[model samples]
Target: MLRLDRVSAGYGRAQVLRDLSLEVKAGEILCLLGRNGAGKSTTMRAIMGLLPLMSGTIWLGERSLSALPAHEVPRAGVGYVPQGRRLFADLTVAQNLEIGLMARQSGPEVREQVLTLFPRLRDRLGQKAQTLSGGEQQMLAMARALCLRPEVLLLDEPTEGLQPSMIAAIREVITALRAEGVAVLLVEQRVDAVLEVADRVAFLENGQGGAVMSAEALRADRGLVDRYVGV
Candidate 1:
């Protein structure tokens, strides 16, 4: 559903992604694994149009997304949850979700679908987002993105600061989304959690591409995980 071809991007002269090519198929969950500073976040930003591409192309299905503006990318069915769970601290959970709805041109059933995916959000609809715990905030972030009814979701460091149980919860949600035909491109620090949800995995190294492997291959090969992802 999403494709990046020989894409290179970075801040100013410090290029972080060097000719990185990758694809996320529709209804599939593709996880990206890399050590810190391996350009995973940069790849995500380039695809979202937050960072200007120095070279190459990004496509959503058959449409070219490389030249589109950042705001337009969301409307084109790409949703991003950045490294930190960036939520409106003072806004109620419902209000934050409502902001996301601005991206959708259709999907009247958006709220119903998202609420079903995140039931914890229902009871806290009126509560301020900042008052929630780490896990709750993460759920709110994902829920807000889902409110857009995006076809492809890009999640960066999603389970970074959550408890094990929360990680498991998020994994279940990722699996459920895939079952429902949502394409997921995830950048995760926790290899095990990502492997649990990913259909395939790619490793990023030193601002360049590394290896692409089936989730099962990565799971069975402990040495590959250690060598590429620092396990």
Candidate 2:
């Protein structure tokens, strides 16, 4: 399991997350929902070691993650897909994926697994990342992360600007990751989209997420959906 033990983090002098504690269990999808400035992205940054921890700790099973540097976090079995599909647009899909292979020096076998996940990538290996469509680029970004063979995956706004078909494909990917016992912490705006794949939901309001509940409960209560998630 991946856990944040009352973690507080921020950028510069402004603190975004305030005493936030949460967990993403193995084989489960924990969706994070929040409005703008709710600190959902900040929370993902804290877990990925991109932001410094102000207080408390983060854990991936028995290992302490709060103190690790950003670059080292990937080797710690944490894969991250930031918003906007941050790929090397000028590079070919194969070259972009090679960057991820450098993290663990993984062989061709692991690379093959990632390619298998997104067959579209297998065909576009020689094409520059910028030439691919939005959905294809997102798939490449995710495939690069999977190339890391991470135990925990953090995704931010994956469905943004995507069509329904692409959203369904990403949903299948997340569900497959869960079935493989890879814990996923998903930061998404679409409640229905996340709920379709998520086991639980956490609402981030005022920089805190204390009310983590089962997806079933959230789905059953229309009022709760109105109160916490307007989108």
Candidate 3:
């Protein structure tokens, strides 16, 4: 339900993304794969209005999001989970989640939905985020974004550094989001992990246009993915 056309973005004179275009349809998990500094995260930043686009257009359904401010992105139906988790280390688990809901007029029911998805958070509502395990922190980061109930979810490596069990949990979460018709734009480097949940894959090449591949093709022979982004 989200599309970026001929998008070029940069910081000052240094360009990171060059004419990148891709799409994420409703209920489909589109995985963005590429080597480090391949503009994958830049694409996500541009989509979330966190980074200014030097030139291009971003759209959700019929609404144009090119000119929307960074603060309005979540309100515009796009939820973002940055690579580092970026949780408030000092804040209580519940407090961090409450911050996301403040952007909208939603009620506690939305919070409940997020809690339901990550049942582990239900009991640690009062715990400081820093004390939680790495996996738990990642779950909380994703849960905070889901509190926005976005039409399009922008996830940047939700399983970067965690145990195998956490990786499985994230995979199952992506599968569940697809079933719920939530369009997901997942930027992950772990080919095997995301392949189980991805319906399609897109490669973000540095200073070039991206190419799309069916998830099946990548699954049948993972070397196809390794060809572009490496194992």
Q: Which candidate should be chosen as best, given TM-score against the real structure?
A: 2
Ranking by TM-score: 2, 1, 3
User: Residue 152 deviation, candidate 3, in Å?
Assistant: 0.8
Clash total of candidate 1: 0
Candidate 3 lDDT at 103 equals: 68
Ranking by lDDT: 2, 1, 3
Cα displacement (Å) at residue 44, model 2: 0.7
Candidate 3 overall lDDT versus native? 0.88
lDDT of 2 by residue, 1-231 (tens): 999999898989999999998999999999988778889999988998889999989999999998788889899999999999899999999999999888988889999988877888999999999999999999999999998999999999999999999888888898999999999999998887877888999888878875788999988875666676665
39-80: candidate 3 lDDT, tens digit per residue = 888898888887889888999988888888888889988989
lDDT of each: 0.89, 0.90, 0.88
RMSD of 2: 1.0
Q: Report residue 38 deviation for candidate 1 (angstroms).
A: 0.4
lDDT of 1 by residue, 29-123 (tens): 99998888899899989999999999999999899999798889998989899989889999999889988887775465888788888889999
Q: Itemize residue pairs with steric clashes in candidate 1.
A: none
Worst 10 residues of 3 by lDDT: 204-213
**Clashes in model 3: which pairs?**
none
In model 1, what lDDT does residue 115 have? 84
Residue 67 deviation, candidate 2, in Å? 1.6
